[model samples]
Target: MRRFLYAENGAVSVYLILIIVPIFLFQAVLIDFARIKAAEKESESAVQAASRSVMSSFDSDLQKRGLYGMVLSQENSEQLFSEVFAKNLSSGVTANAFHFIDTKAVDGGMRVTPVYALASHAIFEGQLLEDMKLKGPIEFSLEIADKFQKSGVKAPFQMGSQFAKNAAEVEKLIEQREDALDEAWHSTEVMYARITTFHLYYQKRISDLDAMANRIGLHTIDELRIEINQVKDQLQSLSNAIHNMDLSMSSMMTASPQSIQAALSARSNLEQQYSTLSQKLNDLEALVQLIIQYTALIVSTKLEVAVNERDILQLQQSIEPVLRLAKQKNDDIRAKLTAIGGSSTSTTSDSQGVNDVFQHVSLIGDNYFYDYQISVASIASLFTAFHLKIESIALYTAANTNQANAANDAYWTLVNDFYSKKSSIEKARMDANDGTKAKKQTERNKIQAVLDKAKQAIGGCSFIQSQSNDEALYNKLQGDTSNLESANVQGFYQKYRQVNAQDVLIGNDVAYDLDKAESTSLRAMDILGVITQASEMLRDELYVNEYALTKFNYRTYGLEKDRSGQAKLSNELVDPGSHQLANQEAEYLLYGFSSCAANISSAYAEMFSLRLAIRTVENLLDPEKELLNVGSPLLVLLVAAAQGAVEAFADMNALVKGESVELSSKLSAAILKLTYKDYLRLFLMLHSDNTKLMARMQALIELETGKDLTQAAAYIQTNATSEIRLWFIPQMMKLFNGSDLLGCKVVGTQCQFNRTAIVAY
Candidate 1:
């Protein structure tokens, strides 16, 4: 004991043990805390990931099918959540994996919340938490909800050669659509013309028949009897002639040879004269028979093929214009019979955050952002150090492109569905009354039944003459009142009215759905506009870059006047590397621009349609000039009807195939430099000549809206000159029309109009 109390060497060891023991205890507590936190984070992340997966799937299903088949159903909820959870979460702290309990429906979608217990064994002086009587595991409940209103994009345009192939295919599809529409337009015009001709022919025949009827008094016995009596009176007057003829007969028997021959000739002349009088009566009878023939033909063809016309001519004068102006539609039966005419052949978005958003540039866009020196090599060596940056931009642009494509799909799908439904409805409506005979048949059956009963009760109604007016109708109605009362005739008609009201509701739903789908597409225009504008900016950038390279070459080689205004080298010589580098930079920039342009054009057309081009072309035309029924002067209307078919076919190839036989883009690019003024002039001229924009302009010069194409062109020139211009900054073009001026920039450039692009598609 005395030695231990004096042991000073062991004192340092005791203090070291106390310090090391506390440090280890603290370290163990921290490790336990970290493990628990990690488990919690894993649970939360799993919930989020599962929710996102469901939402994406829901949207995909919504687009592919309708709402009914979406995976949001209860049957799929658990399986879907489990799949995502497996991918996103791990059981590092716990022995058990997370499982989905249930999914609850939210406002637009469903909520997926999963619960799991995290088993974390703690170290407390080398003993497990279970042995220590502490909690063995912590339960974690995680919830995530999907938002459907936030529409996401899916279909993205591919890069490189894939883009070109896709664009060609879409272009071919558009051409097929245009050709079909135009062919129908021509056929419709011809059909209308034929109908009109038939109407006129029958109308003239009616006029001739009317004159004959009036002269002969058809449908009247008194006139024919009166004519017969007049002929008898003429016969009575000719009695003296008859007696003379009898005396001639006796003379013929006893006369000399010359006298007898003369008497015989006179007798023959009298016989011929009598025969001519008999022929007049037969002619009047034939005229009456012809009137009956016209009436019978009208009945047989069921008022379709009318003679001295009613049905065909009547429709031609009134509804012909309505039929003419309908948007070109597919007539499967007729189109199919047209020998199934020819077939189909085919043939990104830009990221704004990429630090450049130049819609266009002349000298330089004010918005252009390039590092002056510090990171200048970044853009220069785009393929190397900046490859990831380019890839990122491509990805982001692709997402926006997908959004744009998705937005328009719903609209076009709705439109196609609407038309298909409308066609079906029309067929149903046409058969609503079963050729207008069902009502007549019903009324006839009622009348016949009543007449039978009347005959049984009292007798007499053997004659059945056609009623002339309302008196017969009133009498029949009075007679059938008892039957009508028993049958609830008024109530039966009221049921039809109720049915009609239901149809009206259906109509309202159709219109609302169509408008909603279109609005949805329009909402994404801003996003797509960014992508489109970015694509456009690429072209300008390429031009400027190539232009700059040439200027650099000029200065390096000591040109007399270089645009860059740099001091020329003393010797007219430049290094081979510098020259080669400049050429490479220019070419690469061009390659980039062309690829982006092609991809943007393809995606726009693929997601939506190029039929928009057709609509835009049709819109520019005037109503009166295009439609046969609406022309001002009657003479113009007549002349228009005669040439309606020709007019319909005039600009069809241009509208569909995009320009004339030559590609509009190449031609417009080659020799077509359109200033704003020239653009306006060409637009007016093309639209007026090709469509009906200024059909009556020659006569209506006083109206602001209606003036000669020349005047409109001049005014536009004057205005452009007066305004302060943004020369380098190309303003957004007016879609399909304006894009046409840009030519090859757009997928469908209509060169047929021989006009510049008036708008972007």
Candidate 2:
């Protein structure tokens, strides 16, 4: 060994050979390791990228589903998985496949099942596996086989196995995602159903309320109308009675002496009758006032009640609890309906059917209930008041009738008395006239005196009776006459005269007595006139009272009518409230539907993301493993070693042989310092110098001379003091004059730099 070592012939060459060979081997190993590491890193990065893409896809799907506000469905989950698969597979990774299985096993068998699959073109029998996987016999197995076989490759390079494992994991994730999606969809369905039910209930209630209100209103108006008619009839009757009294007065004034006393007695009775009639009329007026007050009270109360009912209905319909429940039901229904393919047409039809049925029932019941109540109350109150008013009126009528009867009796009594008195006086006067001349004169004087006394007594009695009648009539007629010349008044006088007065007496003394009687009759006629006036006044007062009562009745009627209107309005509002409820229900249903859609979308996205992640891991693990198997480790390592050595040598050489580096730095600094006018010259010089230096440095750095100077230069540079100490030189130049070095040139021993100066001025 010593001889061999001591041998000088090829010792240097041999030593050089030994050292170089070992160094080469070491470099080869490093390069081989680096290449393997790089491949592995690349694969990992691709897998990670794919996983991230999958996650993003899932997240996007979830967002589309509006998972926060709604629910998810199965369809959404499937679509999302498919999309993720497409995106992930498109990446450089190997073939990817997606599958799902029910977590709940049937008959104790595996519930897991293959749902979807994707494979690379390089992979053979891809369809066979895909089809087999769907057959349900292949129990939850995920396999990713590369086009190249795993055999005949280096150790620790089972790419296919790794990919298969990754596939399995991905499939598992997809299954989990699918399960989540199902749960979300179920929840959405439940919520939808609740909301729908709530809406329907609200509408039904509103409809019922509306019907009741309308019926009440109609009843109120009818009652008012009836009252108004009754008042009008009463008024007409009073008017007719006044007209007849006027004629009775006119006839009394034209009677003869014999009738005068009878007329006076009749006048006295008539005056008494007038007083009674007036009192009866007053009583009727009082009764009417009482009815009016009561009617007003009832009307006001009914109106208030109607208003209250409307408010109560509104409150019931708008309650939050009701709304919430309805919304929930709506959501539930929507979900179920969607699942069952219940389109909008079917739902709308069903809803309409429910509404029609409920409306028919509710409206009938409500109408009946309200109408019955209103009708009963109105009829009872109105009839009772009417009965009372009529009874009072009838009593007044009876009293007036009695008074009239008394007046008739008195009139006839006075006529009989007047006839009797006239017969006696006439006999006495004849007897006196037949006596002696002295006796005849005395008897004539006595007869004349008796005649004068009789006339005076008749006159006084008629005057007193007429005056009394006139006073009574005046009291009755105080405020009744409208024009005192109506057709009613004229007709009244004609009828009374035809019924009560015509003829009484005729003679000289009789004519004189007739004239006196006529005067008394005129007075009595005037008294009758007063009585007629009183009757007219009473009639007018009754009419006025009737008018007042009618107005009160009308006002009461109006109140009732208004109450009915309000009730109707309240009912009308119920329909709107029902509609509002329906609308709310619809909104709830829509919300449910949206939630379901959102959940579906979210599920899809999650599935897609899981599939994508699986595919990414599979691709990275599979293809890279194949590549590693195919390539020879030793040879790959040798090549990498050579390249690294060459690069290191080149970098060292470039640093050592680089000429004008210091000069270039100086030129750069000079260029930086240049003013705008000098920048062009410096830029041109630097440009040329930089170009030449770069070319030379490039060749040296490449180590074409086969030297190692890179390490030495790196060490020196690392340890060396910084010659270019102004770290802010560029900034300073930019600040002062805005100049940057563009190029550098070497000329003999000097270097020129070119710079471009940005000048504001």
Candidate 3:
């Protein structure tokens, strides 16, 4: 060996052998170390994967068991852990030696220690094993162990306790009451509005009726003044004539020298007086005849307030009570409810972003309860005013002179009376035809024909003359009378019947003069013949007089009933059918008015109560602002519930918007648009805690990449250490204001990474 070491030529060979052997041994060590290191790395990766896989299942397990009822058995846990650990094993590695060395529980999770047995590869078995340990057949055994930790964060929920149970019941009650309130309030308001509108209409109609009646009254006054003036003029003229006549008569009584002189003066005065008296007499008789004829044409009609007072009164009676009931209910609710919680500021700046999907913004305006209250009040006031207006309308009687009281036959009665006279004439003619004759004139068929026609032409002139002869009755006649008989009773039936003044009955253009001998009588006959024409003139004047009494025998179409159950003449004043206030609308107004007050009162009470109760429930949901941050099951459920509610809001918004796409009415669109979140937010506000709710929160924290995700992510760098980018831990911490996740212990804000090393010699 010394010679070899010194010899250069042989030394080279020996040096080569020595260097190669050592080099080979070093190579073996390096190869075995590489293989072992590779295996160790694989094992570590597998452990990490198993841990995460198991931890991620926490939620699923909690779901299956129920959030409140968590029964995590150790046996079941071990089975899960084993199954996961085996699934993550590297190829060629068996778990025959794999066993649980220890198990422990940690905050938010479970800790498991599992040891793994593995075989060395043939590449590192033979010489590498001998060098490390003297082993035959190279039955080299290796065991790898690691401490795996799995965790799950849990939220607290109190679904069955006093706070939850009672609050839930109260919440249900509040919902029911709110629904009732909405119905009642809206109903009452509708009634109030209808009644008010109808009452306004009623007022206008009644005003028109009043005006019409007042016009009639004015016309009657004018007519009465005209009659009084005519009578007064006649009286003045008569008095003057009588005074002058008396003076002349006195002068004639005393005959002397002074008497002779007085007689001459009296004679002149007597001539003037005679002429004046004659003129006055003619004028007075004509005036009296005219008055009597005017009386015959007069008629009296009853006028009254023609309102649907029965229907109107029903509304009037109903409104006050309903309003009172509504007010009472409001008061009662206010009394029952205590103080509610105040609102808290929100952290979210883009809260309205949630509403972008919806088309309508209903909760902001008239759709809200506060506005509904205003609506109710406004309608109530209008109805009250209308009710008063109805009450203020006067129910009175007025004279409608145009309406007839009895058989208002102007010409028919005359014709009938003429027929009666014809019967007597027929008998007279028969007597004259057989053998008799008038005292001087001969009665013939041609004369009879003329008499019959003249009789018709004369009409009721004789009767009219008799009525005209009633001088006192003529002076007493009013503007319009119900009966002509009563008006001219003193003068009626006092005329000379069967007068021989044929000239008076004959036509003015007649060729023959029947009474040329009686010129004075002939003049009277001419005047009497003119009576029919005058009577016709009077009847025509009165017929068109709007205020003149007319035959009101027919029922007034739609006027109010009088005390005698007769329809008043106001039907002419206003159209009853056109005014539809007294129909169904009127009845509904009554029902609503009657019930509105009570309904609204009850609604108000319940609404107020519900408001207070909602506030209380909100308080219970979060007693303090901090409760929202607490890592309890209850809080988790609350967030879950909120999340669900928000999601539902989005869904509802989508649904309504979709349905209302073709709608024309913007108001309907607004009304139909709604979201549960709007109400839910309100519900949350009344919370005593006054904490702002965080939206879309999750609970999970990942401690490693392989265990947290499907694969380990690594960034390429130059001469840089591998940076352990912990992506899951942060993600979990951000899930909520909590530090635990997947039943894993979060030590001082992080999950504790449990690692273990196994050694066997």
Candidate 4:
């Protein structure tokens, strides 16, 4: 055995068994490893090719607008994948090594387990940029984007929009003020009517008192006393009626309720003084009766008492105009009586008796006339009080009337200005397009509503009944005391109306979450690795707005003839049963108006506001208008607003007619022409909330597509994933001779090479 171990006997055979066997085994393992690598490569290629083939079946509707998205179904995607996979494997050497691979894909060990998907705003940005590049040079596209960004400045337009809202509110407030003033003026007129009756009643009382004084000589002391008593009773009744009055006001009064109460108090005090005068008049009547008896006694005794007939006449005349003359006449009559008594120098008892009677008569006459004079003065004072009260009311009413007239004038001026601006707008509309009378009437009705609101605000005034006599007015006032109170004329005129920007009503009520969280997709990039990851995409806001303008339909699109008679663009399949905005999709997207009419109006309003802002800025820049640094800022702003409104209306008309308008109305300046579509793009870019934009876009897409985007196979996916099984590698390994470690288990029976493709645009 030792000799055999060392000897050359069968040495070649043993050496070959040791070295050649190991070497050949090593070569077999190497060959199996190479085969496994080839299978892995071939399977990966097949999956990548299948994915490309599936992507090729893009949605045709999206493609028409230069957008890209796969119109995928599970069965279709699977079949497409299986066919392409089979073709890729069959064309290679791996197909011959693994006969099962050449069979149907399902029969083979290949399987698709999970399909991950991605679709977002970020995904479509790349394709849009590419398509934009093909349409124009990159520099030119960038310039357009930059031009839109710079020219469509939102600050000025936003300020103008707020100003428009403020102006509307102010206009309404002015109308309200005018209405209040009207009510106030009417109330004042009513009060004036009532007070005039009081004034006439007092004047009649004075005339009656004067006539009674003039007839004093023709009547006995008793007759004069009866006339005075009758006049006093009439005055007492008038005072009582006025004192019981319960007048009040519904609105603010120039004279406060307290002032009215004070006037009534003064009348009541005067009535009290007049009541006291009745006692004095009774005393004077008794004294006059005594004087008549004493005068008869003196005459019978032949002791004549000196009395001035002229003094009596003077007393009657004085009663009509002056109360002081009554006292002077009484003093003269007493002096004459005293002289008669002094001049009687008889020492006899009969003469002394006559003198005593004369003295008694003179004293009675003096007291009677003095008391009578006081009575007349009291009536005159009451008359004066009534006169003063009437005068005060007249003054109040006159001031209010003046203010009411002024308010009426101002309101008419405002109306005239509004009409002028409206005419300018009408001219613009006519210049743009002459619609049917019905259409024009419809537009006019909308504008008419605003004017009607203002007109209605002024409202109606209270009707006052005119009276021919004081008695009739007194009777009416006795029944109703409301007109006696003043109204809130000063408050209405003095109150300042304020304008708020946030309170502006655009009338949009579209439901959307602006603060919703969102996930961004990268690109349609096929990355083959252990950890599959998506790429990044462009996220420029201006580009997104540009995309929206190109893809969506506007309100006026129905009028265009090139769209196959369809009223709107059908970007996706819409459910026939649902009630959605079909024609005004673009307008709804921008202004969120539900009806086509509202949408159109809103669009016009928006364009009008923007143009108004631009024009206002121009007005401020214009030194010739002289609207800056003035006492009445509101007036200046109103003037600017008027001009802006006119120009804005014209601009909108031009835009609706598909005519280009200059960004600035300055003809001498550089021309920056903007079409209707360009304006829409600018409006869209004004939306800053990404989530809101996305949600609105998704809502519109779902409405058109008739699909629930949250569900499977409902939305366009940018990313897809598949697991490729290594059937060829496992089968190829079985053909090579190897130990248990060298079997297909070394690389696993099936290889899971995750290949994911993400679409970014």
Candidate 5:
């Protein structure tokens, strides 16, 4: 040994051997350490590969709907894990002197822990969006949503409930107003009848007074006057003879003195007598003629006075009742207006005018006859006063009747307008033509015209104000009824008539297991959380909705069709044509309704509600309606509903017919332009209940595929634990100073790996 130690050449070899031995050992240990690490990596790789392989075996039914899901039992998962793991591990084998170069997967080593999630969640995460890779549909949906958001359109969910209530109240108020109006008309007619009766009574009294005046002819007075004239003539002749006889007596007295003296005495006496007799006869004739004339005048004047007095009394009585009736009618109309929540202040003024006329007529009692004093000279004045009163009464009667007729005409016109609108609405409802673009435009114009006409008519009514409950409510009824008559409305209902919603959406409730891992799909995302950034959520939701549109069948389109011009089949399943749904998976997903018709119709109505709300706000803000801005909030709501429903109906009809339509007719923007899918996309984004949506989607999936989607295993992430044997763990531990460097738990001669991998597609 000493000699060898002294030998330089041999000693160099020994030294080299000594130095290389530990280094080689260290190298070997290092290699073993690396292999253990490689095994850990290989194990992770195996699990990841297995998870993906399992995911690749997606449910064929879900895939047919463009949804990717996997349904794997634990046994099936373990089997798949082992197969893929072993295959991946067994590839590219290499051998070393220190240990086996390739890893060997342990049988039954992997514990498959699948994290189940609903296909909807996975889809929401943009799986189907990525799969379809269609940019146009998603862009279209986003554009539509952005347009509506910018346009300030919102879903009228709450408005719908309130509007329904308001609509009912409005209908009730309208009926009440109609009843009040009828009562008013009846009262006016009664007043008119009373005025006619009073006028007739006054006319009869005037005719009788005229006849009495004419009949008071002076026949007896004329006969008496003739007799007096004859007596006066005889007296005049006797006075002339007395004068002549006196002259002759004077001549005879000159011829015979004694006879003349006696004749003179006699003549003197005779002259005295003759003069007295002549004066007496003249006085008698004058007195008799004057008495006869005075008697006739007094008799005619008294008769005229009596007749005029009676006529004035009758006229006063007749006019008083008519005026009273008029006053009552005016007061009643005012009261009715007040009861209907109208501004009766104007009617108050009208009542005051009526009261003035009534008071004037009432004060015109038999005081006219008393003022004339029943005298002969006053008879003419009395007759004149009575005639003037008669003329005034006749004028009042004519005026009252004319006014009542005018009022009745106004009420009748309003009622007729309401009925005409109603009739128009009925006709529109009965219309069977399809709503084309031109037709829809025409319908929109008609709606606008109706609204305009209603506004004008309501505005023109004097007795009823715009915000009055009765007038506003009538406007609402007319406007809404007319709007409902649009061609779009007809088209919308016509679509439902062929395929009713109640008939198809029969699965009101679906029953399934609650405890299964797949049952977690029943739990939807927290909508409140998702909507924190509505714009972002909406964009993402649009993608998912677009995916449904592209992949599934709705009322208008089919599901995936094969190259052979037939419905594509996955997993030997027939097309949805044989099912009751008949290709309504997309509709079910959109509206969560089992029926295609229900889905479409609900969406349609929702669109109408939304449009109504938007239109209502628009109308409320309109400058033209500003004059009626007060107390018309309810009216605004109703008007918007009417106009919005009509426009929305037309839009939906046009959309379903594959035409683009604006979201709001009032808004003119390229963004507002939307198509059928765009509308469906909006509905999907607006759908707040994700759980129900998922459930419905799952229901339809189950219905078509006969597989419970809740039971369907869709992998979101996987937790895989596998145990592998490693002979160098102890050595690795010692080398690394008892440190588990691989970040794995080490048992005797073995390593445990719990690998969690996200395996969702």
Candidate 6:
């Protein structure tokens, strides 16, 4: 040892060898360490990105295929797995391979095998061993026979043969699995396409059905209008007949000469006939007015009913397909629900990690299934309620039709009786001549006796006895007889002569006498002609007045204006100078005018009353019209609302099925956009930061995010923690006041990572 150390030349060689060898070894170690670290980091980043990408792609694909809520799409599953593998193995060490091994096999046997591979390097070099063996159930052993230096130590590497075997086996399994998944995916795509087609077809059917219903309703309304118009024409004809009868009666009254005893007796007989004809004409006029008013009311009411019924039916039908889809989606979501709770497990421990996996799957199932079920149930319930309401309306409509028919029958019968009586009286008068005057006088006397007996019988009643003798019985009798005498003379001398005249004079002196005599007839007939003329003049007036009242029976579109006209007329008659009074005084007398108006106002009051009764009957027959307008734009809105709701439900279900929540809120926002207009006005009102409302919003926000506001305040004091937490939560809260965030809950608040309030302003 002393001799070796003392050799000067050899000592220099030993020092150089020690320094150079150690430095070279250290440099190699450093290089290898850096390479390994870089590779590890790259692999980890790639894997993380790949996993996230896989989830994103899976969710998107699932939604497109309509499989997220109910069932997994085989195509989407395969595509997602492929995406993850492609992203992970596309970089770093050559020949990197990846595969998803189904731990749960149908045969109850676990198969740990590669399902995908990417080879960029020769397989014989053992480059695929690490990734390939990672897919196995246990640690795979490899023998490396080649010399390799690592960490300053030389080791024999001989894992080439084993790696090659593993690679070959993995490649073979992957190819088989890829084929199977591709086939399954293709089949699933076909199924989904069929489902979509069916859904669209059904939706079209529903739309067509709604359109048909609307057309039916419109047709019914048209039919009702026609019927009403026919009734109005009949009433108008009757009114004209009454007016002619009144004129004939007046002429008959005037035809008798005053001096001769026989002529006086003839005059008396004519007066009786005139009185009877005038009364009959009055009755006929009343009946015609009633029919006109009632028809108008019925037409209006039926139109309203048909509109309502059609709207309800359309709405119900529109939602049927949507409801069915929702139900099916809900069932799928329920199946996914079992995975929901499992997702809550902590990922810190291996056991917790496994729990998370199970929970994730279960949560996905539960959320999708529940959403679908709830949506379906809600829509179904709404449609069911709507249907029930429509049925009830139908029943009411049938009842109203029966009532209208009965009332019409009664009215027409009265009209027929009046017409028959008038015809008989006219025929009897025409048959009478100079030779039969005495006989006719005797017949007239008998009829007068019967009339006097009727008056006596009416007078015996206590109600008649209570009236003042001078003011009631004597006045009534005198007025009635005087009117009869005038009507008889006018009818006999002027109208009868004119009708029988060989030379008909349009404006001769003879015709003037006839006209003058008619002017002196019964007060009611004279008043009727004046009322008719006045009504014609004021038919366009808006306010009810004496003029309007006289024209009340006039109809333009089956709507009653007579009552309104009479009410106005009465108001005017009581206070012609009321226009100069203050609003208060005018209003005070309004009630008095209304009461007195009924007695002296035009026949319009009765017409209006009859119209109201008919309207009531129509409403009873078709109640739906009262609910909503079928032809209005609201029907389209209802259909759109239902469609939007269904889409939202489907979106939510998809998210739940895939355990994906990132875009769930976005889907909910889309849904809100569709229906937001309905509540926009109300939303604006509630957006004010009123004391009561602000407090409620703040409390709700705190409860939802599970973050104590007090703690957030304290954390804000620290710079580091503040920076992290402030990035999203505070900005999000600020941009959206509480109400806006509330809308997010529709898609599940948990997915947002924080419960946010929705500001509606």
The candidate that wins on lDDT is 5
* TM-scores of all candidate predictions against the true structure: 0.19, 0.13, 0.18, 0.42, 0.41, 0.16
Q: Rank the candidates by lDDT, best first.
A: 5, 4, 3, 1, 6, 2
Q: Point out the higher-scoring one by lDDT: 2 or 5.
A: 5
Task: Summarize candidate 2's per-residue lDDT along 1-761 as a digit string, tens digits.
Answer: 99886778977888899999888766754443333333333333333332233233322221221111111123342344334322332121333322111011011110111122111111112222332333422221110011011221111112222222322332233333333333332332232233234324323432333333333333344454455455446545544544444455567687676776765566566556555655655544544454454345345433543443344333323332333443344344334334323222333221222112111110012342244234323322332333233223212233533443343233234334433553464345334323212332332343333334433322221211123333222212121134476533322112212222321111001011212211221221122112112212222222222211111111011112232344212121112222211111111111111122222222222222222222222223222232233222211122222222223222222222211111111111231111111111111121222212221221121222222111111000000000011112233222322323312222232112221111100
Q: Which whole-number lDDT from 0 to 100 does residue 196 have in model 6?
A: 40
Segments in model 1 whose C-alpha atoms lie over 4 Å from true places: 1-158, 161-173, 218-761
Count steric clashes of candidate 5. Answer: 2
Greater-TM-score candidate between 4 and 5: 4
Candidates ranked, most accurate by TM-score first: 4, 5, 1, 3, 6, 2
lDDT scores in order: 0.28, 0.27, 0.29, 0.41, 0.46, 0.28
lDDT of 6 by residue, 44-126 (tens): 44434433443343222212211111122334433453344334432322334442210110111111111111110111012
How would you encode candidate 5's per-residue C-alpha lDDT over 1-761 as one tens digit per residue? 99875767777788899999888777766766776677778778877887789788877767666666677776787787667766776332432324353556555456666555443344434555565454455766555545545654332222233333333343344334333434433433343343344334544444443433344333344554565576567656656766776788767844778876776676576567657666765665555555554445435444543565465455434434444443444444334334433422333321222112112111112433232123222322333453444333321234533443343243334334434443454344224112222343453454455334333322222311122343222222112234666643222112222222222222224211112211111111111122223456545555656655555555434333445766444332334444434334555565543223444455444443344444443443342333222222233334444454445445544654445666555433334565555555655675644444444444445545666454556654655555445554364554453466765556666555667677766
RMSD of each candidate? 42.6, 57.3, 48.0, 33.8, 25.7, 49.1
Error of 5 at 53 (Å): 2.9
Of 1 and 4, the candidate ranking higher by lDDT: 4
Candidate number achieving the greatest TM-score relative to the actual structure: 4
Clashes of 2: 69
The segments of candidate 4 whose C-alpha lies over 4 angstroms from its true place after superposition are 1-12, 90-119, 124-130, 136-539, 558-583, 622-630, 698-761
What stretches of model 5 exceed 4 Å from their correct place? 1-31, 90-102, 119-136, 146-537, 553-580, 583-601, 608-677, 685-687, 716-738, 742-758
Q: How many residue pairs clash in each candidate?
A: 19, 69, 51, 14, 2, 61
User: Which consecutive 10 residues in model 3 have the weakest lDDT in total?
Assistant: 691-700
